[model samples]
Target chain A: MEFTTSQVIEILGTIAFAISGSFSAIQRRLDPFGVLIIAFVTSIGGGTVRDLLLGDTPVKWMRDVNYCLLILVTSLLTIVLKRHRKRFTVTLFLFDSMGLGLFTILGIQKGIAFGLSPGICIALGTITGCFGGVIRDTLLNTIPLIFKKEIYATACILGGILYFTLLFFNLKADVAKVLVIGFIFALRVVVVRYKLSLPRFGY
Target chain B: MEFTTSQVIEILGTIAFAISGSFSAIQRRLDPFGVLIIAFVTSIGGGTVRDLLLGDTPVKWMRDVNYCLLILVTSLLTIVLKRHRKRFTVTLFLFDSMGLGLFTILGIQKGIAFGLSPGICIALGTITGCFGGVIRDTLLNTIPLIFKKEIYATACILGGILYFTLLFFNLKADVAKVLVIGFIFALRVVVVRYKLSLPRFGY
Candidate 1:
């Protein structure tokens, strides 16, 4: 089947999150069923939240069994790949970053399509980008990476703004999407590499 | 305003969860803002998930600003009430149990309204009853009582079954609803009183 650019991005983001979730679950030594459950949650978590907030019902995954099949296959592949791979942390981080960028852009576009305000769109984008990881980490009893890494949602928000700016400047929509995704992915990498974080405040 | 039974149950459940969440957040020493946020999540989390699954748009809280106002007021009331009371744990537990019963019945009725199968309706009921506390406990970084106690979702499931059975037996709808809710609430209390728990297996 011929796929649109948006569809391709969605598939890639889903796969990336599935693999990332598998790695986290495996690291926690969860059983296979637990790993698959986590993978499903991570892969669909963001989109589900975005769709629900937009009042788009039946959720994406519930309506599309294909996504469920894809996540299952990807998770199984991740398990097989783990046997041959020694470095999980770095690989997990890379796929998660890619998923974050891709999902964030998609969420922003969805918000725009829904006729929401720019601020609400950015919030939606950030939520779609970060909530999967947040839920996954929370389920695994770890501090969510968003709480530890300040730049996580910031990257999505800034990338969202950039997308709107690019659109305003007459950039091709396709080109703008790619640029925004690359911007978010690169921003996350740079921040993590430098261990950059916002200052902590006591409540 | 003439409130229907279902609306009354929804309001009571919302208030119960709001108070329960406030007590939890306060016990954790979170700021007032944090308490309000948790309260909102605990009250609306299950309903939001249910709405998304059933293709009910705008979810509950987003469409009805009154619910948000209710939760905010309830949370603030909880905070004020805390100053005059030294025993919060029991109160929190009681309210949580009541919320669980109320939400489970509401979810089952929604599922029935949607023409879902009995099994699916039961699952919806369980999810609607338990997910709020699950999210709340996860956010608080504590082991969810559902996982530890095992009776949480079980009560919802059994209660759901009882509701269906009563209807099948020609019991009045309103009477059945009240009976099921009371059964769930009382079951929880009895199980906790007896320290009943399912056996845990290492995964």
Candidate 2:
């Protein structure tokens, strides 16, 4: 299988996600192993969910040693930087938004590969981009950001739609990925900067 | 298209997992929506896990409305009987153990269908049968049962191996399921009764 540039970006996005998760665990006063687990889960959890949805076995992380090492290194870095967590949240969120955008496209691409309809692919993309954070927040006993603040996961959905919509116009795959990621990142930036929010329902 | 006796037991087990999860959520004083999420996840989590491993789509609950309704009923029951949660833990454990054994077999069966060899099948079975509880605990911000006292994901792995071993002798599938569930359930009972413990790793 070709590890395209987009796939490489996807891995970096995963690493960034792991950092976000590890920082959360560190703030909660968890031990190093606990930190690593949180990092590992938060980074790859969504992709793992997507893979499972597509019936891919051994998961990407389980198949690739690099993902595991990324989480471990991030965890160690988290422990070393425990004193600076509050200041890191904003920095982490930036990386996370990038991850969100990238994973969304990756998930959509996988769904397409598995022959799912475009509608399902977009939903898969949204889930892939957001579910890891949901799992992380839930584990930390906080309300998930996806359900609360920012235009995060929703941006991913819109971008994925744009991806397929652009593809229908016969846009190149590389260009489609760039356009979707750009859309998500910009949407997230505008939402965060303006303090925008999604409407919440208790049910 | 045979609904093997094992399949029947697996359904019952799913119900058990749902009950346990709902009850646990009550002990945590979750709201109604929280209860439903917990119950639904508990019931379908393992099977959903197994299906994901097999690269199945829509997970299991998304396909069948009954699974959702069953979990809904359990959550409703929990809301009604919130006062008696401690008393219900025993009943929940009984079902959980049954669910554990049945899901284990289901996982192994799915693995075999995927043409996996016995070793991976057992591992998949063990993961399917246990990961849900791990997830539930992680969501609750508690250390998982895997790190604490439990006889095992215990019965599932043993029963998985037993099922494949029995198949080596070409025993009837129904008879094998009964034997495996019975043995696993008995082992669980004995373990709980004696307060059995695994050797702990020092942190």
Which structure among the candidates has the greatest lDDT? 1
Residue pairs in steric clash, candidate 1? Answer: none
Could you tell me which 10 consecutive residues in candidate 2 chain A have the lowest summed lDDT?
Answer: A28-37
Cα lDDT for residue B28, model 1?
75
After TM-score superposition, what is the CA distance of residue B148 in candidate 2 from its true location, in Å? Answer: 9.8
Interface RMSD of 1: 5.6
lDDT of 2 at B198: 48
Cα lDDT of model 2 by residue, A37-69, tens digit: 678778888998888767687576645656666
Q: Which regions of candidate 1 fall more than 4 Å away from where they truly are?
A: A1-48, A52-126, A132-141, A145-203, B84-86, B197-203
Candidate 1 per-residue lDDT over residues A1-203, each given as its tens digit: 89988999999999999999999999999999999999999989999888877778678898989999999999999998786467888898899999999999889888788776675677678879988998899799887876454467678878999999999999999999999999999998998999876442122
lDDT tens readout by residue for model 2, B1-203: 67756557666777778877887777677887997888877777777776765567767788888768877886787678667545776875776677677677777777777776676677678877877777777776666654445565646656887888899999987788778878887888888889875442221
Residue B192 displacement (Å), model 2? 16
> How does residue B181 of candidate 2 score in lDDT?
74
lDDT: worst 10-residue window of model 1 chain A: A194-203
- Candidate 2's docking class is incorrect
> TM-score, each model?
0.62, 0.58
